[model samples]
Target: MDVKEGDVLNYDIVVVGGGPAGSTAARFAAKEGADVLVLEKRQEIGSPVRCAEGVSLSWLEELEIDNIDSSTSRTMKGAILYSPAGNKLKITERLAGDEVGVVLERDRFDKDMARLAVKEGADFMVKTSAVGLIKEDGVVKGVEARYLGKKFEVRADLVIGADGFESQVGRWAGIYDSLKPKDIMTCFQYRLTGVNMDPDFTHFYMGSSAPGGYVWAFPKDENTANVGLGLQFSRLKGEKTPKDYLDEFIENHDDYKDGEAVDMVAGAVAVTHPPEKAIAPGIILVGDASRVVDSMTGGGIVNSLKQGKIAGEFAAEAVREGKFDEEFLQKYEKRWRDELENKLWRNYMAKETAMQLDDITFDKIIDALSNIELETVTIGAILEGVKKKYPELVEEFQNMI
Candidate 1:
C-alpha cells in the first residue's frame, strides 16, 4: 500500500520490518483483530537476502506454519561437523540442533510469511523505512517513516522492532546497546551450483578456516548449495574480509573449487546474548534487534519466529486492554524469556568455551563424539561423552555441564 506525502496513519500496532519476525507478529496480531501495519525498507519483501536460510522443521510445526512446501529448497536429513583436521561427526535431524532440518529459498519464504500477514488483514508498505520513533513524554508512540521519498508518521498503541542486525528502531527507543566487536560476526555466502556434496546433509567446518566461527554448506539440491562462513570481528587480521576467507575456503575444497556462484550475499550478524531489556514504554524489540541469534551457530530464524509469536499475542492483549505502558508490555518480555532465554544464555557460554579451543582439541572432541553412539545430541551430552574419553578437553565446559 502507498501512503501520500505528509500522511498521518494510525494503527493498534506498527511493525518496523517485514522479515519473518515482523511479518509473523503482524499476522498473529491481525489474526486477533488488531489494526496492524508492517513497513519494509526493501522494495521487495525478501530481495537480496542476508540469511543462511536454514530452519528446524520442529519449530515450524510448533508455530503451525505448514504452508511452506513451495518455499522449501531442500529437506535435510542431518548435519556433518568437520574438525580442523577433517574429523567428522554427523548428527541426524532429530538431534542436529536448530539449523539442519530444511534449506529455504529465503526470498520466497519471506514473501510467503508476509502473505500470511496480509491474509490476516495486516497492511504493508514496501520501500518504507522507520527513520525514527514517535515519542511523547519519553514514551514511544509510533514511528517516523519514509516511503518513496515522502516522510510520514504512524501512530500506534504499540511498536515492534523486528529490524535486523543494524536495527535503529531499538536504539531510537533506548532499548538497545551497541554491539561490541567481539560480539559481531562478519559473514559472506554464495549460492553455488555444480558443487559435489551430500544433498541430504548440511556440512560445517570448524577451526582457523573460519577463525572463532565456522563454515557451512547447506545443500539446496543434489548439485547446488549455499556455501558460507562467518568470522568473529575481533579475530580478524589486517585487511582480511569475510569474503576473502570464504574464497580461500572454497578454493581449497575440491567439492566447491569448480563450482560457480550464481548469487552472493554479505552481512554481519549479532553473536551476543539477548539484551537485558527489550522493551520500553509502548515498544518491544524482537529478532536481531533484540540480539536473539544463537551465539554458537549464528542461527536466528526459529528464535525470531518464537519471539514474534509471543510479541504479537501480547500486542493483541495490549490492544484489547488499551494498555501499552512498559509495565504492561513486560508480559511479552517475561514470556519470551521463560521460553528462550535459558537456552540462549547456555549457547552464548558454550560459544565462549568453543572459541577458546585449539584445532587439536576440536579434533579430539569430534573424535570422542564419533566413538560414542549417543541416544541424543546436545551440548551437555557431547560434554559428557568428551569427559569420559578426554576429561581435560572439556574442563572449561564443566560449568555448562
Candidate 2:
C-alpha cells in the first residue's frame, strides 16, 4: 500500500532501515505470515556502499543464501596479518579467525536481501525516513516518518530497529546506544586498480599506525581491491585523520603505492560493548543499532544476519501471540545474545588488551604465533603458544579465551 500524508498506515511489523538486518528481519517475519513493511531512508536501497564486503562462506551457508556466487567478487583463502615491524603471521583458511571467503559487491548483496524480503511479502518503501518513534502511552507502536517530501505515520504492533551504526531509531526508543571514543573506529577505504597482489588472501596490517585497530586490503580482483584502515577515536592525535594514516601506509607499502586509486569510502565502526538492553516495549534493535560488530575484527555481517533472522522470527511470534510488550520483545535480545554475545564481548576485551600493547609487544606476539604449527588456529591454540613464549603478555588475555 502506498503511504500518504496524515495516514496512520498499519503493518504487523515495521522495520526501519532496509540494510541487511532490516531486510532479513522483514523477510523472515513475512515468511511467518506477518504484515511487514521496511522503510529505507536512502533513495536506493544499497547506494553509496560503505563496506569492505568480505563475508565468511560458512555463515552464508547457514543463512541458505544460494545466489551469493553471483555477487561475489573474489574468493579468499585466508588472511595474512602483518605486525608493526612488518612481521608476517599467516592465519590459514582452517583458522577460527581466518575469515576465508568472498568479497561481495555490497550494493548488490543488500539489494538481493531487499528482494528476498519483498518476495516474502514484505512491502519496502525507499526514500522513506523514520524521523521519530510513534509512542502510545509510553510504548513504541510505530514510527513518524517522511516519505519523499511528505510526512506520514506507520503504525505497527512491533517496531524492529535495524538502522545502521548511527541509528536514531534505537535512541528514540530510549535504548542505550552511546559509544565512547575508545570504542569507535574511524575508518576510511579506497578502491584501487593497477594493483599487483595475490588475489586469494585478504591482508591485514596492525600496530600504532592504525592504533587500536588495523589496516586491510580485501581483494576484489587481480587488479582491484578495497584498501582501508580503521583507528580508534581515542588514539587519534592532533588533527590526524584516518585518511592521513592510510596515506602513510600506502606510501610505506610497495603493493599499495603501485596501485592506482579509483574510488574512496569512509565510515565509523562501533567497536564497543553491545547494549545490555536492546529491547523496549514493542521495539527491538538489531545489527549496528545494537552494536553487534566485533570490536577486534570490526566484522558484523555474519552477526547482523544472524540477529536479523532471530529478530524477524521473534517479531512474527510476538505479533502472532499479540504480545508486544517488553517481556515478549526481550526474547529477541536473548536469542541473538545467546548466539553471538559471548564472542562479541570477548573480542571487545581482546581489542582493549591489544590496544595497550606497544609495537615490540605486537612484534613478539606475532613472532610467537608464527612459531606455532597447527592444522586449524583456534583462540586456545594461539593463546597457548603466546603463553609459552611471552607469558607476561598473555596474562591480561588469560580469562578472555
Candidate 3:
C-alpha cells in the first residue's frame, strides 16, 4: 500500500511529541529529504521544561552539535561531591574538556533544536495531542491526533514516539510502558530568587539527607538558581515527598535560609534504559519515551539528541527501502541501546540496591566515596565497600552486581 504523491494525508514520517527527541528526529529526517510532521501537545516550545540543565561538553562534541550563542552563567573546573558528614571531594572536569559542561538555558536550547528542525522543513502542529495509533492491518501506519477540538488522521510510512516519561505511544505500540518502582525518581525543583549560590561547579550532596538520591543547585545567576532535590520514589514511603524534602533542605541550608521561590517545577525522570524493543512495525520510540534517560544524573539532553538523530535517519531509510517491518526498523533501537542501554540499566540496578541501605550504611558509603578517587568511582567499587565494611548489606545488593 504505497502512498502516491499528492495525498494531503500522507507523509514519509510522522513524529509525535515535539521535544528534543522529536525535533531532532524531525530535523535530521527532513534534512535527509523526508517529509516530516511534528506534533506537540503543548502550546509553547519549551515551557514547563523539566531538567537540571547540566550537560557535559563531551556530549556536544560527541554529537558534533554546535553551541548556539548564549550567555555564560558560570564555568566550572569540576564538581564538588559532598558526604553525609559534609566531607568534600573536588573532582576535575578535564574528562569532558578544558571547559566543564555548561549549565544551559534548556528552554532556549530546546527552541534552537526546534528551530533547526523547522528550518529543515519539519512542520509543526502545537496543541495537537496524539490520541491513538492509526493501524492498517496490524501495521502502524500513522496516527489519529486531536487538534484544538477536532480529530485528524495522518498517514505515514514511519511513526516515532518522542513523547515523555508518561508515553502513550509506546503503550499503544504494544511495548511494556509500565515503570518498575526502582526505575523512577521523583523530582522537585525551584527557581529561587535572592539566594547567594556560587555560580561555579555544580554541587552534589548525598546522605540520608536525600536518601536514594541527591540535591543540586545549578546557578542561573548570582542571586537566583535552579535548586532541586531527587529521591527515588521507593525511598519516600516512610519519608517525605520530594517537595517536602526540598523544603527541609532549603530551611536547613544557610545560603537559602530566606530564599524566595520565583518558580516551581515538579516531575519524574525515568531511570530505566531504553525499552527492550525500540520499534515495531512502522513505529519507533526515542528519549524518555524509550526510557533513555540516565538513572543517576536524570539527564536526557545528550541521549535524546543521539536517539533523535538515529530515529530520524533510520525512519527515512526504512521508509525509502520500504522496510516497515519491525526487524528492519529496529536498527535505531540497536544503536541507542548499544550506546547507552548498558550504562542506564547498570545505574538503575545499582541505585535499587543502594536505596535499600539504612542511614548508617549510607553515611559509611559516602565516607568511602569521599576518600576514594572520586572521579573514577564505579558501582563495583561501592558494592565491594558495602560488602567489606557492612557485610549484611551485601545480600540486598548481590543481585544488582
Q: What's each prediction's TM-score?
A: 0.97, 0.96, 0.88
For candidate 2, write residues 326-362 as lDDT tens digits: 8777787789989999888888887888888888988
Global fold similarity of model 2 (TM-score): 0.96
Q: Each model's C-alpha lDDT?
A: 0.89, 0.86, 0.77
Residue 87 local lDDT, model 3 = 67
lDDT order, best first, reads 1, 2, 3
lDDT, candidate 3, 1-401, per-residue tens? 22222333678899999888999999989988899999888987777768778776665555546764462345556677666666665656653344366777777777878898988888888888888988877888898877777777788888899988888888898776678766788899998889876667677777766767889888777777788987877667865688889999889888876889988989998776557787878888888888888776788877888888888888778867888887777677787777778877877766656666666666676565555553344566556755666666677767654
For model 2, what is the alpha-carbon lDDT of residue 367? 89
| Model 1, residue 83: C-alpha shift (Å) | 0.9
The residue pairs that clash in candidate 1, if any, are none
Best by TM-score: 1
Runs off by more than 4 Å, candidate 1: 94-100
* Cα lDDT tens digits for candidate 1, 1-401: 67788899999999999999999999989999999999999999989899788777768776768758989999999989899888999898666655458999999999998998999999999999899888888877889999989999999979999998888888877786688888899999999999998989989999989998999999999999999999899998878899999999999999999999999999999999879999988888888888899999899988988898898888999999999887898899899999999999999988887887888988998999988986677788899998989998888889887
Top-scoring candidate (lDDT): 1
Tell me the TM-score of model 1.
0.97
